[model samples]
Target chain A: MKEQILKNLSNYLELLQERFGHEKIWEELLISVAEYGDSDIYHNSIKESLEKILEVMKIDEVLCALDIITDKIEGFPKEDLLKYIIYIKNEYCLEKENNLREVKEALTELATPIIRIWHDIVLTPLIGTLDSERAQAMAEKLLLFIDANKAKYVILDVTGVPYIDTVVGGFLMEMIKAVRFLGADVVITGIKPDIAHTLVKLGVDFNNIIVKRDLETALKYVINLIEKR
Target chain B: MQERVVPIIKIYDCLVVPIQIELDDTTVEKIQKQILSEIENNDVKGVIIDVSMVDIIDSYISYTLSETATMARMMGCYTVLCGIQPQVALTLAQMGVNIKGIYYAMNLENALEILAGIEE
Candidate 1:
């Protein structure tokens, strides 16, 4: 069983290399096999392979590798398989999240859509700690959802968010810009006092995003804004 | 599945219930059973659901909390949620789970004050 599993992994690697190109396969496919293949291969083999690939790989290469592994092994229990995938995904998320620092410097380069008004979609919620990358992702996702649904307004509620920094503050402003580009009004709600103080200390301007104390107020504002428009 | 220790204490005629767990379905069921019996047994005028220890609050848990508040109100008991984690509160808010009618406080002591006010 052990030898067969190694053979199968090598064979699968060969196929992956042929189909996806060696660099793509090497970066992406290697992690999945090492993680989920029959419980025969030595852990050392997995670690050594990972270490060699990681040493020279770019951030994108590592992210691609994680994505591939997550796609392939998501079905298995995290205890059994997905743990490694999650570890890589978290690393990828953190890496990309950190990459947003570069984006903050090039804030003018950010292409935020015009806020459009859609009467159909009821509410839009923004969850997760809004780092620049996650904020950008959320902004883009919100725009897409608004445009696709012709949503009249979106509620950007951040009450569940634990903390925010200067980068995240800028990201929120960028999100407001993006939402505006989609012709949708975005109501920013759930601003806890600590985050509000952080925004003030960071010297970030939220003049454009409509502010509300909480979701109920945001929802009420959304309803009124939609009604008036 | 760690057992949560909730002490039922009387503070100026109101029942102060300090909850120490995530407000998920499992915890909600346990709480519902516990609080209902406690409310019936004590005939308290107010209840404080302390959530300082809860880390996560999805829509399901929010709905349960909201329902609990409603039921408490129907039974003539005021309910308040205390020490809600900011992250959990944010998620619940975005998910459109409004604990609108229920009182919210920063800590168990503050919640007790709010409940005590209602009791008096």
Candidate 2:
């Protein structure tokens, strides 16, 4: 049985190389096939091999490879082969989803970081688009940071942020108010022209908040404020 | 029966009014009247309305506070609102109630400092 399975696998591999002409696919097939031995292990190894093949080759090509092997091996159940194909497809999709989730979480962590630039001064540099969810997460994180650090001045530098909508603007206002309640004054910097226009059109009142044109000016103002204190 | 009056403590030329109780429409009106009267009687330069102890402020109270500030300004008394809790500010902002043109300080000490600066 082992010798026959090995012979059929070699034929399928040759056919795949001839059709795809990809060295990577052959390497993946070899690794997946290495696990082929006992009945239970063989079933799992076949599923893995199909997944790797589906990644590089089309489903029709995989089916053709299975057909070639089935003809040589007597009593090779066609239903079992189809079931393995379905299982591999589902596993591949699940893995892709998990990878995407991990990347999104990493990006969120990288985008919002509260740095204590000076004594009594905390700076949160926002990057990417300020969506409502990210804004809320940022707000919660910032409030906790201000309370823990006893921050007197918070500079929300939006130089890295590409744009802000009305929902995000509301979130930012709430964040500013919460920070103020913690006895910390908040300064919003790097308001781009388009974003400023959007905010105005949205009727977001900036009267209560201190806004600076750039980080440099904000830093200067903070320095003067600390000095005065 | 006499109306409840919000106490106004005279600290030099600055009138310090600490709002220790929740304000209804009548109480807000009474406080406004008391503050304006104190400002007029003593020729106070600044009025500090400390809302630090007050937990909640509805739109009516917010409107009254802003109106009182404007009234005090008309009487030549600068008004400083001090010690607004974070939750109160957030709630007020969410309710679209803003007291613009009124100065805000983090605490009574900062409020006094701001008043002193304005007096100079």
Candidate 3:
């Protein structure tokens, strides 16, 4: 079975090289061999020879070549070869999905850190898009940190947040109130004019909350409050 | 059962009423009447409603509180609400009930400080 497969593959390789160029044909052949090789010493040797023939190839080209080979190979169990291709495609897709999920989790942790900048003062600098899940996670994290640290003041720097919708606006209000309940005042900084407009249009009242133009002003105000105390 | 009465404590020239019980319609009305009467009797300059122990505040109660604050203001008393739980504030904001012109302090001490500042 292995000998028949290899003989058909090599014959098709030469036919592909004649129709396409030698350079393109060899690269696609190498990738196909690498993707569909069986776990046998003989198949491993076949793959090694194909690898030496090509430097690099696009995955789409290799998949295309596989489709052509499965069709052209006469009397060989085309079903078996197609199964191997399907298995390889599924594995690749799963690996890509896993990598994407890992990146998202890393970004979430990176964006929502609660840092204690001074005694009785903590700063939470939010960056990236504010979605409902991210907003809820931030609220839980900031509230827990304030209660645990006994922080008197929290400076919420939203310079990196691009915009706010009604859902996020409501969650932000909830977070501010939670901080106040824990006996710590929240100072919001770095609200862009556009965001301010959105909040107003959403009918969000910021009359009770303290807002600052920038982090510098917020820090100065916190320091003065501490000094006065 | 005997009718529940809200206590009004007089601190200096301010009438401090810490709402330790949950407020229903009758309780809120009774408290409002008591607060107005106390303001008139003591001639106090400020009224502090400490809501630290009260967990839930509905729209009706919120409206009542605002009305009571307005009434107190008319009778020459500054009404300050202190110790409103964070959850209550969030609920009120979500409910779209604006407690406008009513002052809030973090605690009773801060409420007293605000009243003192106003006195000065």
Best by lDDT: 2
Candidate with the greatest TM-score versus the true structure: 2
- Per-residue accuracy of model 1 over B56-108 as CA lDDT, tens digit each: 77767777877887887777888887766544544553344546457866556
Looking at model 3 chain A, report the run of 10 residues with the lowest lDDT sum. Answer: A46-55
Instruction: Supply DockQ values for each candidate.
Output: 0.01, 0.20, 0.12
Off by over 4 Å in 3: A1-110, A115-122, A140-154, A173-186, A193-197, A200-211, A225-229, B1-4
lDDT of 2 at A43: 62
TM per candidate comes to 0.37, 0.61, 0.60
Indicate the docking level reached by candidate 3: incorrect
**CA RMSD of each candidate after superposition:** 19.4, 6.9, 7.7
Residue A97 local lDDT, model 1: 79
Candidate 2 displacement at residue A32 in angstroms: 31
- Name the better of 1 and 2 by DockQ: 2
A41-119: candidate 3 lDDT, tens digit per residue: 2344334434433224454654465567667754433444445445555766899999998887788889988999999
